[model samples]
Target: MKRIKFLYLVIGLTIFLGCSKEEITSIGQQGDYITNFDFPTIEIFAPAKVGLTNRSKNADKFLWEFSGAKTITPQGDTISYSQSEKMVPDSAFYELPGEYNVKLTTWKDGEQKEITKKIVVEKQQPVIVVPENIGVFLEVTFAARVFQFPGRPVSYEWDFGPAGTSTAANPKVTFTTEGPQLVKLTVNDGDETLSTEVVIIVQGELAKTIYFTDAFTRRIYKYKLTTQSESQVEWIGATTGYNAFGLSVKGNKLYLSETGFGTRFSAGDAAIADGVLKSYNLDGSGENIITKPVAASLDYRDDPWMHTVDRFGNIWWTCRNWGVRVINASSSEAAYPAIKFNINATIAGEGVSTYFASDIKEVGNEIWVSYAGTTGKGIYKYGYDGNYIGKFTTAIQSHAIRTFVVDQVNSHIYFATNRADAGHGLGIYRADMDGSNIISVDTHWSMNIGSGGYSDQGAAGEYVYITNMDIDVDEDGKGYLYYGYRAISDIYGSGNPPTLGPSAANSGVKRYNLDGSETASFLFKGYAPYGLAIDQVKR
Candidate 1:
């Protein structure tokens, strides 16, 4: 009797399994419909006309509910068409910026299923045009770009924080404070309102500010220097991670290069990794890591030592062992490959392999890079295409070339070096573009500890013995050269020990006229400046 009961159950189970596999159902069976639809998942800007398409199967009836949407008629008038019994509804228009729901319901054989998807409409912000450079007490013009609303009249209101507010489309505002000022713009188009904000950084009264990186503190500092205003040193509040070495200012951006994971004395391919090149807005906003190393392939040879930004938006950096590398500032790659000039190969010597490719600068359409190592010591010039032009200068090759800057207005190339060599005597040297008529710019103060100078590391302790320099013209059309100076108090007379290193009285940044005359001495006193840049834009 039990075997007969089991046989009956097995037959029932077999019939049920066959029905499920075949998807065979009676005319009034439940759950036999597929409800599906699609809408744009990309940003939908209002007023947006979004089309909803049906992809349902085995459904006898369909319904669509578009939350609070209107459909445009053939005569151009918008009418409510929020709900429809059709499979695909008319194009729904989202007049305002917000989130809306789209519901699709399908019914088959007296059973029903529904699904809902969200559609978000984004607000289109008005475009605001602000001047690149703004200074305290300086009147600058701000404009709201014309954005047509077709049939509706537009009105603009600008809120320049601390500078007051304006209703005019273009407003001339004079900021009274230094630092970031949040400027907002709101546009009303009778039907919809859109808004946006931008931070307008108001700089100090100086027409030009000298930006320098302090490697010891890993911080950025600025010295506002102008003949018309008081010279002041302000911390820029931007912290550069490990081994901050280079700073370059192009337009409203400040670029920095950090040789990650190694000290200046032991930096090499094997000793380091995680190097990066980054950029920050002059106001310290928009901090971004432009490039770094890819994890799977680690090579510190691609580490950025010193960098420069060209007008073409290309960032050229000198990798200590790998020569120079170039990548567009807008690149989104995890790591950028180096343009291996194998620059050391350019020099003919056994020790050329140990040659360190140092600071790089962008002069017009060309790139100039300085190299200093055991063998070759000079600046090499390259075309904008990364092809080596020639050896820029061996004039001061006796000294380790830490940095060099081109003065187009003055037609001079300034070289700042260490090692206090006999012929050139490590300081600041200026030469013609062709490396002729080399003149001493400023070599009187103390330089880094190398072949000739004493080591200050034991006392105050210097991390890297390097000097960075830059050139910028003022509003008065006068060009000046600024270079970091690590002065030994007794370089000439007083016998202060080398361990005493850089003193507050003599160590700082030195400013000189284009013709090699000293302008300001002992600026940013006591701080050992490494990387230097100048905001050349007239603020």
Candidate 2:
């Protein structure tokens, strides 16, 4: 019985030992054991000294102790233990830059760990310098140097203060206008940014000669009749945009046609009369809308676009809707009363087409009007009295006509016409005062220069210069002709079925001897050199 009791006791003891072992194993699996501890160490240097204060991490509680001037006990994970209070060291120390170290201790469970880190801080920010106050002249080019901190990715932004801005590390910028400008630059570091500013004064100067091309941007430029290469020019703005036809000069005044207000359709509402005659002073100041006449009732398409100033300073213009109207400049309101005469009624022709009147010379005592049209293609000479003196057929397709010069010395009338079967190439035709002896000089030879090709005409001494469909020429008294060949494209016909291939190059003004031999060809500056007026302004 005693032996049985001993065995039972041994079994009970074994079960008790197994239960304790299982409890200890479960506790280990639950991560209750003391493992490891870690802390971050720091080092600092200022002008060259370091301070320390006790810091710890992962501890249920913290106890910080520092060695140096004072002992500090910080309760947080991080503490600044430094001897000096300044963040950066001064550069006054020429040789040795000081270094410092910081110790950090951490406790977790029953384990503890410590670490140290070193840091060095420099004094003062980087410097950027530029030359002292420099004055730059307007529109003048100059150079300058730029300085900045070394060993850094320096970014620069220059604010020229004159509204000019740039991003050049070291750049040369030119000032075109006069004013006080504030120049500034900015440099950026990964962690910080710096900027500097300078005041710059720019002086102004006079601009050179102004250029006047066609009615681009609706601005009119007037040039003085002088030979100074750099003469100053003035710009005048038009109330209504100027068309491609250009301006006409008579005496000391100028005359231009303003196709009033753009519209969407032919029968749209009249926005201040479809056509207006504008007059300007010689100095480009006293600009006045001289005439506004509703000559017709057909929605005034503003089509038959042509304007000329007669010797009496009166303006004569034609319109697709308005047959023909004459403006009396001498009148208080510049009245334009329709010309009442046989030609105005008989040939009252719709789309009166192209017409030209001389700038009023004393010879004929009557304002001679030359007109042509597609419906009834003929050149008619009308007297100022509104009487049709005579009419004659010059060419089958004489859709338009322009007077080159009415030579009172020779009683000869010179004009240009687009008379081809297709009405493309224009021809230079001449006739006597009575409309006889009409002849056509094939201006384009056999090439297609197309309509709207006739450019300009002028008289320099006895030689009369005529610009035709694709050529320019000067007619000598003895039947001698000089021609300038030019290349021109007809944009009006570009949409025809299939393409007209590329526009041919029979363009560029070419000069020819009166006998039709090629002379020197003077190329113009741009394409479609349509409105060719001699800049008699000596330059």
Candidate 3:
């Protein structure tokens, strides 16, 4: 009977609960706790002064009271907090990053408002700094933010891609080879790890190129000295007009001048072509034809040769039969006023024809010119305006100099004697610019006995190079002066040193000590080369 009574009580409770396993409480326990809201925020890296854009930021401070509510921070981490009178952190300074909560409260006329926000701080990633491009044997400094940040962990690793790996946070790397290199950096802060990666280009040694217009190749080419790695055998651009002869290099730009020797240049093409000066990119792109019109000089040459630019960017050029002339190449238009300088203007001798010049150079505030064949003084110094200032060297008359270049070190002129006779000519000659000390750098026998080629010469630092292309053929491509250099031999076949003929043997660029001893030699099959310009890349 007692069991039946307990069962009835259980049934009554079940009817009230209605199949739900929920606690049934009296109204006295309800509405006892206050409700709260959430406002979470997040940020990254450093400079951690985060700002909160609150709509009620302009509310009167007197109506709101501030306090830091229940704080839940990561273990062993401490955070600095600054609060305003409105109950919000003025500067969100989370020194140690982790998950935590911050609160804001507001009161107006006895009305209260409250907010609870969760703030998450992530580990700052390391920033790496290195050269985007570097040459061989160059010292590259690697830097990282992890090494500079205040209070950063001492544990860090650095990997310089294929260069090598290092335990240091900051390392200096030098590449022996050339190519793209990948770099990685990692840092640890006891609780978290941050990583960063970047790619660095360790470029190889800039190609050792001789930029020149080969009358034989009939195209301007950049011949490489190192190897087959960084060079092109044939690189031609749109014909401003074929049978062109000289190119000037400034920075990465090339200025090629076409001499309308026209039918005079080639026999089959009877059409008279106009001489044009055009500008091209280093790799031979962007042909900008420069058409500056000027009345032909009353007394001299018209076709242009190698040109030079002044500090103010003025184009000073030399012509075949004409004296030195100036053109304002600074304008963008294809036309410019050509100013012809008086050829009789001279301080040395009145008979000097300024029009007969080659290799026009502007060094400092002065302009210098080199003359070929049996013309006026071999080299002449002049004012920028073509007024002869003085004589550089006596007439380059007898030697029949094929080409001449200046020694960067002093006022010495290095000229090449182009006569075919072995004993009297076909040698390298250097003399003071003022016609003072004349010395035979390499005689005909010296060339035939060594590397049997002699055409052009260039000097840089402590070394001088000879471009050995004996000119036995005409400038029309079949010239022996093309590249008739063979190995240097003390004995020429039989008795004494006999002069070799064209097609006998040939070589390319030969490097020699200041004393004319062959230190090294680079051999090429055949080339129509003139003048050597060593371009040092400026990073």
Candidate 4:
């Protein structure tokens, strides 16, 4: 009975101790609590007094209010809060000039934070300050110089106090007559404006000027020849045209053959059929058409193509269907048949087409005609009586031949042979007036010479000038020959070929010496300037 009582007492004690420990654990778990938490700080990188927007990231909520605003509201990252008293971006574009302060309050998770910043709205207009010293001179054409501060003013206006007109910006203006003139210039940006003036004294004549005339813009500019100042020379309209193919001058008269304007053509016939041959004075005055009113035919196959003029002032030309014709120097309207070669009847079965007549020279009583047929290549001679004086044949098919005064002091007839496919460089040959004792000095293709047979066009020389065709000799007795060389781009184009322009490899007029040395060239303005004539006029 005593043992049983002890067991009961021990068991009771253990149960009581376990109950007390459970109570303590429950109190400790309930004590883990938090209160009065502060919100996280915010750092703003924007300027102070700025028009603020809620740009905070990862925030649950926001309570925003500006310093001077009447009401406060909940704002988020997407919500922007603005105040009428607060300045906005671009609001004072050209008005206000300085910076301001602004404040923002953000609230998230029952916590509130405030931010402060400064902002500045810039004016669009610039500040312009004109320079004080402006240089002046005696002549109205004197250079008008002005300076400006900041160098980037939006607008500038210039007034040259005399009858002279007003211009804008930094400009150079010349006066017509000489005297003291007040020059004024105004500069402005949207925000600021400034003005500057200077007294100018100009002297000297404003007459006699240089000018330039392009094909499209026919405005002739007149620039003072003394100081290279330019002005308007002439105003040409639809009445004035351009002729790229034909240009010749006699005395003070200039003749040009025009082939209509624009690129409208059908089978070589311009819409305004029959091209015009017009004449004008050297000073761009007294313009009139000398050719007959009947539309001048652009018939290269049948009619006469005026190639060049001779020393005697006679216009010598050739017709494909007919023969050669001569125009009197005094009257261009009068044309007479000087000689007609009976090629069709004389050659019979041989295919012949008179491409062009080479240069003509009158030796003694006979006129030498360097004629080349399409099939038979040779130099044909004709007497003053229109009688054929036989021919001298070259090895290759000849297209054209030019005669140069070879040693006029020695009276030797030197002609250059234009063979079609033989080679580059000139086939230099010398013959008598009757075409005898033919000697060939093959130049061979040098770096100075172009390639192939189509290259040899014309040659010119004094005593030492001998090329396939054209040759010009300097005082050193060396010969420079001018030849027509077609490039790969020439045969496939419609307009002017690249080989005929200023950047051509072998275009324009070429110059060489007697021993085939010191070759140079000059770019001719016209396209394919096949005909070249140099004569001394009584300027």
Candidate 5:
């Protein structure tokens, strides 16, 4: 009788457990409800209305929560509310620029499921776009950026003080005034008008500027040529990487070269890659690395020593131990061969087969490269396409040309060289365009050539080397040549053969009238100058 009672109790317990499991499964299946929503294509600017579509299944009760949203009543009254009914109101409006959350909570069989979505409304305004620096007598374009709905047509009006006004979307305007000029833009998109104003500084008509770099400081400074004060120098910007050796100006940009991280004798892969060709705007803004050294490229081993931009917008620079390298500033290829030399060639004045190509310049339609190696020590001429044209003169073979500048207006070449023989002093000299009639330009000191502190040996020789020069010609065809004169510091080098004495005062930037007359001695002082350039408009 006890066994029968136990079996009956087990069967009863099984029946109760089975019924409870089935009931729970049915409840969970009913709770599996889906919620979905989507928005239409819209600009979603301020004062916008958004319409949402509901895609839900197996839910009887619904709740909509709009976080601090706004809406318009039946009589066009604006009201703020938080929660809404089962069906969202078509009059829901977002009148301010911000983010809002729209939520949907559904209930089925006492279980709740919710979904939240975000909406972003953008501010309605017009943005003005213009160049950072604008000059007088130069045409500049101004643009206005605005948003319009599908059927709305936007119109723009611009007002440039002293330069007149324009109704075109983007207007090309020129200002004759030199001071601060006010620019205003008004954009209308049928419903509303938004406006913005900005003040643009228009540089003077004859603002001549000179840019030069300091090797010790690794920074560039500019001085207004029109300033009559006592050398008021302004810092433009600082350089990156290592040696800031080369600088040039073309159009509205200044190009600079940093010779990587390590010394020329100790360069590794990192040092080669660190070498860069960079550019900046006239105000020292917008620093851009035009190109950098890469593996197997010409600049990989031979870093950029000196650089110049050609008429075709191609950047041509001389590599320290190799030949010339070129790159289209707009091309994707970084650094490629402009001219490569056969290092095994005989040491004769036949071609440009030198290990040291020092400086480069774009003269007329040709490119001139200077070599300072034991063999080819003069300037070699080449076409823009890298074909050999000829050499400047075999006479210059005796002097190691350090730096030179061509005065197109005066038809003369001013070069600085290191030679104390053949009547050539360790100073600046001038020659005709064909390299004839060479004469001394500046050999002011009696010790410029002989056994004084300016010896042709030791650190003193390097202190007197002119590595940077540029020419600026005015509208009257008169030109001025500017060059850096590094002074021999007391810490230059130890020993008596070469010393830094009172002649160290000869340091700073020296200016000449192109006729060899000293325009200004120590036009700028107190720093060791290296790379130099002038903001002369392209002729």
Candidate 6:
């Protein structure tokens, strides 16, 4: 049995040796190209591509083997991967950061040569830190703050508060609600992934508001000071004959003088020629229910241009041609015209019968008046009893004043004249409280002081407002100051001199900065805004 096993093994060895010697002599005769077993040295950063450049010498076919097949694509070389080329390309890129043993086998004439190379992919791990809570407004967008390892050539995904999302690096986002919101940011660089979360505080729209009167459309418009939204004042179409000429607010009550020439004082024309002085609560309750009547009383006619309420609840208003008139107002019964001031009483023996006050406002204990007449036209001061105190324009050219605005903290009185043509006194001026130190502040005047080609000014404030009759209402609602006059395309008919009440696209107020630079224009839309007032109720 031992001799038989030995004989079989000896025969098997003899056969393999004979075949090997035959194959070697045949390959030597055939001039096979498989000679070098070498590869190029490769060094690169992690997660980047690797090149399997063919630099072998005298090779007919090549095979590559990459270990740890899980992290690599086209995992390992197969039996059919022997390509007929000296330089062999890789199947896919390497994505993991670790040393890999790559085996290369070259074949020519069925003779094979093999080599191995150690590829070290260096590591790059970045740290990410998400920010804290960021406050954002629900109506206004907020630019997000982010701090992360930069220059990584990474892709990002952002989940902004619940459902909002963005791909921008520094994204401006508006949240849906007002509260603490959650945000998530995820970053990835090939095989590396990182993410973080933060809270964001979102603010909501405004609740309280500011009001304006549209004299032409017989309505009042309100602007939400906090949210920057504008709409009409309440009790508008609810009550007829609600034309507002000038507006004043005191303790939840909005007072308006809505009288001018050739105007129907109604939403439906049920007025008595001229407009009426009326009041409405902040929520638009109590329209002309128990206040100053819409009729002439105490020998003073019922034509008031603008009105103001004193601390005593008395109404001091401009009575058109009848100077200043005071009315005892109440929420109880219809009030009567109390005191009338046709201050014909001479100052330095000059009777000022042409002294017709066009607008009035109360600052502190005294009431200030802006008038437009042939004589004694300036910002005039008066006591609570309708007695004339002094004239402010006496320090400058005293003529043709229209609106009065008193800034108590600065002791400066701002007023605008009714004339807009050449040589007319400044369309707007500022002066000391005691009728001195007169200085012009308006920057748009001279050729056409007011738009619509008329010579009269309207609402003025820290942002001065100008009333226009149907000027650029449908377009941008803006007008420019050209040659010192507000230049907007005239909306009135040819040869028609402008009037106090205008129709159509209505009016807009241009807000001018203190340096006379124009800031913004808020259109009144459906109404002609003649006068402006602010409600001091804190919200």
Give model 3's TM-score versus the native structure. Answer: 0.68
- lDDT (10s digit) by residue, model 2, range 257-295: 554433212234433355566666544567776766654
Candidate 1 vs 2: which has more TM-score: 1
| lDDT, model 5 | 0.66
Model 2 stretches astray by more than 4 angstroms: 1-216, 219-246, 259-273, 294-298, 301-304, 330-336, 340-344, 347-363, 392-404, 409-412, 421-425, 430-442, 445-523, 527-539
Q: Which candidate, 3 or 4, has the higher lDDT?
A: 3
**Candidate 4 error regions (>4 Å):** 1-298, 306-313, 332-359, 393-506, 519-528, 537-539
> Model 4, 1-539: lDDT tens per residue?
11110010101011234545442111111331221112112221111122233344333333333332222223412223344321111111111334444454444455665566654333322222233322222222323222223345456666776545454544456455455667666666554776667665554443322222222222222223233333232332223343222344556655444433322112433323343455556455776654422434434322333333445665544433345555553454533333455543444334465434433455555555554333434555566555766555543224244333344433345555544324323445555544555544444423133342223211221111111233334445443444322222211123311122233333223333345334333323222232222212312
lDDT string for model 3 (1-539, tens) is: 11110010101111244577654321122332232323323243333434443433222231221222122235733344445442233335444445556555554435566666665554455678675557766777787765233555567788876678787756788776777777788877565577889877777554544555543434666554443245454555533443354556667666665655331212232223245676777677887766533443321145555566667666776655545566655444455344455443442555544333555677668886655533343555788666667654343434444456554444456665544322345556666755556666555434333444342221111011222221112223221112223333211232111222343235333343333344334435454333334333332
**Model 5 TM-score?**
0.55
lDDT of 3: 0.47
Off by over 4 Å in 5: 1-205, 227-231, 261-274, 294-301, 331-355, 444-464, 490-506
lDDT for residue 356 in candidate 6, whole number 0-100:
56
TM-score-wise, the better of 3 and 4 is 3
TM-score list, all predictions: 0.56, 0.41, 0.68, 0.38, 0.55, 0.49
Cα displacement (Å) at residue 12, model 5: 97
Candidate lDDT values, in order: 0.68, 0.39, 0.47, 0.37, 0.66, 0.50
- CA RMSD per model (angstroms): 15.0, 25.8, 16.2, 29.7, 16.7, 24.2
lDDT tens digits by residue: candidate 6, 167-269: 7665556554657777777767555676767675554343444566653444665554343333344534423243245677788787766654322112222
| Candidates sorted by TM-score, best first | 3, 1, 5, 6, 2, 4
Clashes of each: 0, 33, 24, 42, 0, 5
In Å, residue 84's CA in model 2 sits off its true spot by 99
Ranking by lDDT: 1, 5, 6, 3, 2, 4
Which pairs of residues collide in candidate 6? 54-87, 220-233, 241-266, 392-435, 445-484
